[model samples]
Target: MRLIQINKTYGDKTVLKDVTLDFPIGKVTVLVGPSGSGKSTILRSLNFLVTPESGQYDFNDHQIDFSQSISNKEKLAVRRETGMVFQDYNLFPHKTVLGNIIEGPTQVLKMGKKQAIKVAKELLAKVGLADYGDVYPSELSGGQAQRVAIARALAMKPRYVLLDEPTSALDPELELSVLKVLLQLAHEKQSMVLVTHNMAFAKQIADKIIFVENGEIIYDGDPKKFFSQDNSSKRIKNFIASMTMENLK
Candidate 1:
């Protein structure tokens, strides 16, 4: 997926200005930045969840003008290929684990109940929650909830997944569960863009790291190069210093 000269503004204040970058498919690309740095906006814009004020988005073979009016069908079609995993699990309170995972496919995709349930079961097993299908979201730990969210998104068979601080709301141990599941997806050749503050995990699982400051990409290159840059901006260096393996250990 590619963003070309993208720009977004709220009234007179611009959030992202002329941002252009290419996210390689079939690899993990981590987007790192402090709060309100437009990292989340960039991710949201890809799905037209937050339409940009200007610029073009290039998907596998289609071009989308952020400024153009889009039909609901058009938008949902794009969204199907671009799944989002939020900081909160966003599971339905009344739905069981299996219900939550299969809801979208059965309801939105018009899939049969049995087919959706079959797929949901396979995904639950994939995320290491094979025995939790009958449980409700309220009964699961944060990590389990988040893993279910991942499975819910994956059930749609998205070509690219967008994650916004996936572990932010979890305790350290719970965070590991979510991270381990995502890390395994990297091995599966899942293409994803993750917005995270977990620098240690970024270095470990990301094939590329995009550093953003004040809404612009300051660095977009190999994850190792990001760590070794002597001339790295103070903002980036400071960000790195804040990350510790204490949580990972």
Candidate 2:
């Protein structure tokens, strides 16, 4: 998936300016930066959750242009290939875990209950929540709930799973369980775009890291070099210094 010449503006505030970057297939790209730098906006624009003022997006054979008006069929097609996991679990309060997971498959994809439930059960087990399918969202711990959310996203069998600060809502103690599941996904080579404040986890999982500030991409390259990376901007270097695990520890 690739985004080119992306631009966005909110009144006087220009959120994204001529942003272009490639998300290599089956690889994880982690976005990091100070709050309000528009990292999340970049993620949101990928599926047109927040459309860009102008840009071109290409994911496999599907290409979209924000420069022209887009139809609902185009929008639905983009959404069909992607899934998003939020900081808050975003599970339906009235629904059981299995109900939440199967909703997308049964309703949107027109899949039958037997197949959806069978797939849901396998995904639940993958997230280490096989037995919790019968339980309500309120009954699970923060980590467990987030795991269910991950499972819900995977139930769609999307090509890419976009996460916005998925671990941010969990307590420090509960973060590991969620991270463990993510690491497993990493091992299985799932493609993902993640916006996060957790530098340690970013360092661990990111194949590439993009640092943004003031609504522009300042750095876009390898994660291995990002920690010790010395780029053109001193301000970005300082920001990296502050967020690196060495400084945190």
Candidate 3:
């Protein structure tokens, strides 16, 4: 999937300025930046959740022109290929874990209920939540709920899994659980685009890193170089130092 010359704004404030990015297949691409730097918007635009004012988005056989009015069908098609996991788990409060995971498969994919449930079970196990299928979102801890959310996203079998700060809402211990699932996915070569604040985790899992600041990309290359104190830009060095300090606190 690729975005070319993308530009987005809200009134007088420009969020993304001619941003072009590529998400390689079977690789984990991590987006790291300070707050309000347009990382989340870039993540959301993958599934058309946050439309840009102008640009081209190419995914598989679909090429979307953001300057034109997008049809609902076009939007749905893009979303079908991309699974989004937000900062918040966003699970259905009234639904059980099994129900939440199977909803998209059974409804949108038109899989049989039994088949959807079967696939959901496998995904739940993959995320280390095999026994929690009958449990409701309200009953699960922060980490458990996020795992279920991951399972729900996986059950769709999307081509690219887009995560917007998936572990940000949890404490460090709980964050580790979610990170483990993500690391496992990376090991299995699942293509993904992630927006995250965890520099340590980003260095560990990223195949490519894109650093954004003030809605512009400051760096887009090797994670090793991005994290290297001596090699990175002064701005990036300061940013990393600040983030590291914040993490220590």
Best by lDDT: 3
CA error at residue 23 for candidate 1, angstroms: 1.3
Q: Per-residue lDDT tens digits of candidate 1, residues 1-249?
A: 999999988888788989999999999999988788899999888888788878999997778887887678778888989888999989998999999999889888889999999999999999999999999999999999999999999998899999999999999999999999999999999999999988888989999999887879888998888986584577677677766543344
**Number of clashing residue pairs, candidate 1:** 0
Candidate 3 per-residue C-alpha lDDT over 4-51 given as tens digits, one digit per residue, 9 for 90 to 100: 999999999999999999899999999999999999999988988899
Q: How do the predictions measure up, each by TM-score? A: 0.94, 0.95, 0.97
Global fold similarity of model 1 (TM-score): 0.94
Candidate 3 residue spans exceeding 4 A from truth: 246-249
lDDT score for candidate 2 against the true structure: 0.90
TM-score comparison, 1 vs 2, better candidate: 2
Per-residue lDDT for 165 in model 1? 94
**Which is the leading candidate under TM-score?**
3
lDDT order, best first, reads: 3, 2, 1
Separate clash counts for every candidate: 0, 0, 0
